[model samples]
Target: MSRTAHVNRTTGETSVDVHLDLDPDTVTVDVSTGVGFYDHMLHQLGKHGGFGLSVRTEGDLHIDAHHTLEDTAIALGSAFAEALGDKRGVVRFADATVPLDEALSRAVVDLSGRPYCVHDEPLEMADTIGGDYPTSMTRHVLESFAHHARICLHVSVLRASNPGQKPDAHHIVESQFKALARALRAATRREGDEIPSTKGVI
Candidate 1:
């Protein structure tokens, strides 16, 4: 079966569209969200996960990036869920640890058709990365994605920065996204022709 999905969402605060193909003939990423850092992160996600993904989002950036980031994640997560369908023949559980420069992050995922998220990070992350993308929104994005995707996700920053140096929000956040991407790639992999859960429906 082809694993692909598209989602379009519009609201008073934002308009978002996402297309995802878990098993694509050619992996590609195209993202435009008006937030440079967030776009870069999404690119990393698609590239590292070895999937084809695209996203276009227009939000009230004059107000903040919260709406755009969260809404985009919602759409992307919905697309992921739709692409997986009934989650048959999937690995269903995986974990990854990634490091970017001095930052190290870990992510664990379970495609158990349950929506839950646990995000842990240092309190001293840089305020923002690309001026418009706030570091705090990272957790919100993960939470929103997990909820919409109906997956159990856990992400943590094992190391924030080099000793005696302040946390680099860019590296910290990038590591988290990379780890999540890798974990998702593994968890979504085709393993066998059976649902991973004992319930036979996940």
Candidate 2:
């Protein structure tokens, strides 16, 4: 199916639009915004999800990545919700645990007509959980994405092998996305092309 989705904010702060098709083989993402960090995160999400994405943002990034990230999730999630149509013949559940040297994380999804996010992941940098790096904001984005996408999501960091493990924030984020991607790919599949739920539907 084909779909289009959008998200608009009140602060005149953030706005995003997403166009997506689940069956595309080569996902193309063209995104530009004032926030570099957010751009990286979006790339990770798209790449890991095996999704081709294209985004353009005009936000007040002098403040931070908050608006950009959250808005992007809103749009992307809405697109997924729109595209799923009736959630027919889908696997509906998947799980993945990803490791970045000392840091490891797990994410599970249920496209079962509801949205939720649980993050039990570990972070090596204070930048991840605190500072402007807002872990809560990231979680908010995840929750918004899943909720609107009509999917249940759970993310956990089962281990962080060492604090001295990796010095780069990019590595930390990349590993997390990689893990998420693997899990999402599995969940989106049509197992035996069967409807995974006992209700005879997704």
Top of the candidates by TM-score: 1
Per-residue lDDT of model 1, residues 17-135, tens digit only: 99999998899999999999999999999999999999999999999899999999999999999999999999999999999999999999999888999999998877888788999
Q: List the residue pairs that clash in candidate 1.
A: none
What's the residue-level lDDT of 138 in candidate 2?
58
Off by over 4 Å in 1: none
> With candidate 2 superimposed using the best TM-score fit, by how many Å does residue 92's alpha carbon deviate from the native?
0.9
How many backbone collisions does model 1 have? 0
Residue 85 shift from truth in candidate 2, angstroms? 1.7
RMSD of each: 0.6, 3.2
